[model samples]
Target: MALDRPTPVTFHAPMVLAVGLPPATLSRAGVVLEPSGVALRESNLLDLRSDSAKYRPLVLLVDAELYDFDPEAFDMVAQDVGAKLGVAGSAREAEVTLGQLMAALARKSAFPPPPSSADAKTDKWDFSEVVAAVAAQGGRE
Candidate 1:
């Protein structure tokens, strides 16, 4: 009697795409694509302070060929929305960059926490002292 071998299971992590490229082009890049609108929706959902943990591994893919592309702004928006951003001129490069980012994220997730310092001190200030300090500065309007 022969034993059956276990089947390989594939895992697909959730991702958000904000690229201007066609779906066909992005699909060819080996990335599981979600609509750019989802990114906007996620942003709004986050603004409402709703739980979006289901949307983990979210990334904003931007086509670097765009005429008015602002990488700095894109990065800021991605950070605000708690998502990663990757910009590439070509689909192949985008795939490579995304893979690298995923690997880096994985490594970061496994990192050990920093050791606590035994000499750390917590400063406790008196409320009356704070009021007196404020009054010395001419007080609030």
Candidate 2:
């Protein structure tokens, strides 16, 4: 019996939202700043954690020095939600970081694909065929 391979899950466009930074600055850096300052809310965290795969990768640009922010809380939430946490001391630095983050996100996967059972079943030896072809060509193998 033939086994069906499950379809891969396609996530939506990755989002980069910021807190404590002007929308204009983030826009210049190619990121859309979330208008609300509710980044630490339970509802947002829950949604982020539950629907992480449905949405694109998230990077939250936080200016803790300028705002009444909790770095530990943000880090925990980011980890739980599979999001990246970036901290900037000033608006200028935030812009620079956001730009860098955007560039990194645009790049393709940095890691290799995971091993799977399907890989084990795939044909591994092509040397015999190569040897036969070489012999037919009256060439040394």
Candidate lDDT (C-alpha), each: 0.56, 0.56
118: Cα error in model 1, Å: 13
Native-to-model Cα distance after best TM-score fit, residue 1 in candidate 2, in Å? 30
Candidate 2: minimum summed lDDT over ten consecutive residues — where? 34-43
Whole-model lDDT, model 2: 0.56
Which runs of model 1 end up more than 4 angstroms from their true locations? 1-14, 29-57, 114-141
lDDT by residue for model 2 (5-101), tens = 9989764555654555555544444432333121221124445445443442466666656334566766765676677877766657766676666
Query: Against the correct fold, how does model 1 do in TM-score?
Result: 0.45
Error of 2 at 29 (Å): 2.9
The weakest ten consecutive residues by lDDT in model 1 span 36-45
Candidate 1 local lDDT, 1-141, one digit each (tens): 998999997653555544564454466444423222222222332332222333443676667765144567666666766877666677676667766765665687799866666557767789999889889887565
TM-scores, each model vs. reference: 0.45, 0.48
